[model samples]
Target: GFVYAVTTADLYIRGGLANRVLVIGSETFSRILDWSDRSTCVLFGDGAGAMVLEAGEGAGSIADHGVLAASLRSDGAHKDKLFVDGGPSTTGTVGHLRMEGREVFKHAVGMITDVIEATFSAAGITAEDLDWFVPHQANKRIIDASAKKLGIAEQKVVVTVDLHGNTSAASVPLALSVAVADGRIKKGDLVLIEAMGGGFTWGAVLVRW
Candidate 1:
């Protein structure tokens, strides 16, 4: 999938695959030393995106298909929790990614669990069946809470937020590449991907190697 949007990090990226509803989080604002009175650059920097999901089977069971099932959800009430103020009409520009970090973090944890649960229920699976549980790598604490809520094994989660610093949609696939290179996500393994972002959009995807 290819899209045009002013990234919170001010990056211009186009085109990529959406494997299930992989969750990739962006926390670009955390790097800002000052969260107040920076008219030049508001709380922009953090943003995230997920892959465009497509279904395919290869003589695979829930453990064989590239993606078995997925779910998505969002709430408008939290719209202001995180957002950019500028737009094409206002400044003839893409605004910065401003947000209430604490608030969004709170909502993220709860919503993430909901999305994963929905995926599991729809797929008729359980946490025990998951080989890898990757969440939007926005905050370590958030990742911990969501995984814990879903009863996912600690060993099954892969974290790339530290190195990538939340490339938004790029996070999930980037980490997948890492695990693939490291020989962690072997063929036929069940992988779960999830993420939450600006529009309060969030979802999960279940895939098999």
Candidate 2:
């Protein structure tokens, strides 16, 4: 959802549909979780994060303010790998989250890094050019694997999973906020953001901060 939010805002700005857009990613996984299920219950927490994007004039280079490039992708084939067991229309009740953790982890790093590379290609930049890589706060292992695969330095990745748990949609933005607040991300910095979610949905966004 964080990737979806940022991509949608970027598209709107590029399409002349809007000048400034507010994108938010929030989730309350606790409400739907089966507390008895430790696997899913203990891994998530409720949280929200937001950002406002405004139009800016640039020289059509990588130095452009706001979003420079983005890539969004989804695969329904892996939908059952991580999902809830019930839905309002299907089961008439909100259901507990269920997941095949090992299976999802196996595909996550590759899926995430693929989109990040695509975004870098689209922006005419590389991981070496990034000042920060803020990925979804799903877990330390996934975050570490993705960064390592992309060759993005450990110092460049913004991680907040330890402090916030897996806030689902809120992960990226929350991590970004932390990086920015602590001075790791700053003016003119090139930042890369990415996420992979339950529907097997995933995407990446490149921005000049």
Candidate 3:
């Protein structure tokens, strides 16, 4: 979700459609959750995030201080593994969130690494070249496993799930904000933002900030 926003903003900025774009991702999972269902309800949190992307001039190289590359993918075959049970048109109700937690974790790691690798390849760099990796704050096991598989060091990964349970669409931007506010992410640093969510959606966006 965050990757899609960033990439879309990049397109508008580069295409001369807009000088700046305010991309915001806000979610209120608590409202849609069934509080009685501890399994899925407790795993979510309410949060919102906003980012402003403006036009910038660069040398047209990998060193550009903006969105460099992005890779997005979605597979509905596994949609039932992670999704809400109701919707307005389908069920005439906003249903509770439902998921097969174990099944999601199994696919999350593989799907995440696949798209991230594609982004890295498109930008002609590897995990070692990234200054920081801010991934979806969904699960610690999945986050750690994905990084380990991609060869990204532990210290370079920005984590906040321990602090903020999963914020859905707000995960990446929230983590990015935390890292930035703490002085971890800084100017000219190569950062990679990745996320996986309901609908079996996943994506990776590389930026030089």
Number of the top-ranking candidate, with lDDT as the measure: 3
For model 3, give the 10-residue run with minimal summed lDDT. 86-95
Q: Against the true structure, candidate 3 has what lDDT?
A: 0.91
**What TM-score, over all chains together, does every model reach?**
0.73, 0.95, 0.95
Cα lDDT computed for each candidate against the true fold: 0.66, 0.89, 0.91
C-alpha RMSD between model 1 and the true structure = 7.4
Residue 81 displacement (Å), model 1: 0.8
Ranking by lDDT: 3, 2, 1
lDDT tens readout by residue for model 2, 1-209: 98888888888988999999999999998778778778788999999999999887889888788888999999999989999876654553557788889999999999998999999899888789999999999989999999999999999989999998999999888999998898889999999889898879999989889
Q: What is the lDDT of candidate 1?
A: 0.66
Clash count, one per candidate: 14, 0, 1
Once fitted onto the true fold, the runs of candidate 3 whose alpha carbons sit more than 4 angstroms away are: 88-94
User: What lDDT would candidate 2 get against the real structure?
Assistant: 0.89
Candidate 3 lDDT tens digits, 62-149: 9898899999999999989989876644543567788899999888899999999999999999999999999999999999999999
